[model samples]
Target: MGERRSTSQSLVSWTRLRPYAMISPAILVFCLFFIYPIGYMVYLSFHDWNFVSPTKEFIGTANFTYLLSNLEFREVIVNSFIYTFFTVFLTIGISLLLALWLNRGGAIYSFLQASIFSPHITSLVSVSMLWMWIMDADYGLLNWALNLIGIESIPWLTSPDYALTSLIMVAVWKGIGFNTLVFIAGLQSIPKDLYEAAELDHTPPWRRFLRITVPMLSPTLFFLTIIGIINSFQVFETINLMTEGGPINSTNTFVYYIYQYGFQFFKIGYASAAGVILLVILSVLTVIYFKVLSKKVHYR
Candidate 1:
């Protein structure tokens, strides 16, 4: 029996088969939830089909061409890039700082960490509503507090100029908590031995942080950066709920615009085209990022 088992293991390569078989369920789920819909959306992108209509006509790349020509679509694309850039950048930097502060391990650290992470567990719609109330120039908590401190009330969501910024602020505030946790995990993983070695050499705090901490934490930072960018790209519900694309489409993101086209306006085909384009953009950027940054990500 032992010889038979050894022979089977050697011949069948259980190690290789086990790993593949273990992840088969996850792969199946991804195919069902992610790949199939994406493929269908791509197929739909080339045609003109209304959700209510019975027919779908092939228009080749006409839908994409039309989207490119549409001034509003162009603006949406630009807005997506801008929104993604600012929010992801700010989220990473702010989350890192907060993580470092919370990593100090004091009586107040637990309270602060929990408070920051609280929003991450809360519902997005609820969070948006809370911020909407907070940003009210006339009666919102933000402006009311500002008035008490001699600061003037500003139209946060009402003004097109500030609407996008306000949305960005709310997003950053909500997401920073989760990112902070990832960063804290990274910070905690750094060995005390490294810090002790640095201290022996009389390394300054900032220098030790830069030389040891940043390098060691690069893997977590990279992960958070990718996740942050992806989340910011898909920021539809919050903007839709809070501002409904805003005073003049200022906050209409790619996903929200796609949603508006697909479901709201019944332009299913056109929206599918937009979705496929976004998928392509995301896939390309992700590939480039991993190709470039993977080598630099320090993993211990």
Candidate 2:
């Protein structure tokens, strides 16, 4: 009888632990890939180390101080914010308009929607390469088209004045299709009865949209806003491929700045500090976004 009791107790214990055992691999992966890297990055931020160095020198906050006081780093921060602002604003605004116009059912609308979204599905590297050719100062499609309209060739990526603006344009163009599709989905989810009820009161088109449509889309708008801010702040591929953060660092952003310091300049500690700053900024922005917009989002 004692032996039977022991076996039953052991079985119960194993059953209790089985779920945890099943999930252990996923937990291990999360720790290895996510938590470990972040912790190591934080550790590296406080020490000076070349990529090939045998040992890291403890520098405390010197790396951060250098970054904060550096004029180039300050400019990179400004460029990042400016790029994020324009990219998010234009992408959301234009996509919202497109979503409204294309929300109806039709073959033509379907084709147009597919066409718009095609750029988004294509790889970013390929898109960057294609845009490079299009925006080339000489013998580029954009300049060619402008010259046809009796306008002089404007340096799209070569001029400091236009380089950042050109990057913003590419980001907006790439993002609009995805945003529009998401907006369309949100619009469709909103019940038709809401509009019908508003129309019964002889409401103007704009008033109906403002009262019914806008409120219903608040959740979608909030979602897209947060995502746009995060993605825009991380813009790197286009800057790297198209401009290489050139035209006097007009297009230099946080990620590219970190890449330069870490990889090109081999300043691992400095790059880690920039990475830490980016992480902190993103975290603060996300928290603020949730706090401000949580009450505004109208669910179902």
Candidate 3:
């Protein structure tokens, strides 16, 4: 009887191990690609080394100290925060409004959805090139339109004051479609009966929307907020292709700064420190979002 019981226990243990065995390949890939690289980056952040140098000198936290004290780095940090806030805010706000307007089922709505989402599927490089031509100060489409409206041409990408705003506009336009689709999904998931009941009670449209639609859509909004903020922090491609962090570094975001240090200057250790700083910033923001804002989110 004891032998039989021991056999049963062993079988149960093997059954439990099967799931872990099945996921072992994924675990290995995660460690190899994600965990190991992060660990190496953290280790590299403590040293001072050019990518070409064979010797990595242990300089402790001097890299971080320099970044904190550097005025240019401080400007980069400020630019990163402003870019992230406006991009996320405009993306979510416009997408929500669009979703609300077009949530009803119809052929025209379907066409509009497809048209709005087309930009998202399009290549960023191509979009950036197209926008550059359109935004050209000399005889560009935008300037021509402005002239017709009796307004002078504005330098969208050339002026330091307008460079970052131009990038934000592009980012918001590119991201609006995906978030709109998500909001549409969230809108559809809401029970129609609630709206019907509200209508039967003669609830004002605005009040119903404020009470029902907003509450039900809180989960979607929360999700988009988190994702949008993270993606905004990593803004690089548009800045790289269009502005090159130029107009006297007006658009020099954190990721672009990392690229400058790592590839342009070949200061791998300094770049690693910047990357680590970015990671910490993201982690803290995520935590704060969850702790402070998540309570208002309706998970259902």
Q: All candidates' TM-scores?
A: 0.91, 0.95, 0.96
- Give candidate 3's TM-score: 0.96
lDDT for position 166 in model 2: 94
lDDT ranking of the models: 3, 2, 1
Regions more than 4 Å wrong, model 2: 1-16
In terms of lDDT, the poorest run of 10 residues in model 1 is 8-17
lDDT per residue, candidate 2, 1-300, as tens digits?
Answer: 999999999999999999999999999999999999999999999999999989999999999999999999999999999999999999999999999999999999999999999999999999999989999889899999999999999999999999999999999899999999999999999998988987898889999888888899998899899999999888889999998899898999999999999999999999999999999999999999899889888887
Give the Cα lDDT of each candidate. 0.91, 0.94, 0.94
TM-score, cand. 1 vs. native: 0.91
Model 1, 1-300: lDDT tens digits are 999999988878977788898999999999999999989999999989998778899999999999989999988888889888989999899999988888987779988899989999999999999999999889999999999999999999989899989998998989899999889988999999999999999999999989999999999989988988888889887888888887799888899999999989988889999998898889898999999999999988
lDDT string for model 3 (174-240, tens) is: 9999999999999999999999999999999999999999999999999999999999999888999
| Model 3 RMSD in angstroms | 1.4
Q: Give, for candidate 2, the lowest lDDT window spanning 10 residues.
A: 291-300
Instruction: Give the higher-lDDT candidate: 1 or 2.
Output: 2
Question: Which runs of model 1 end up more than 4 angstroms from their true locations?
Answer: 1-25
- After TM-score superposition, what is the CA distance of residue 59 in candidate 1 from its true location, in Å? 0.7
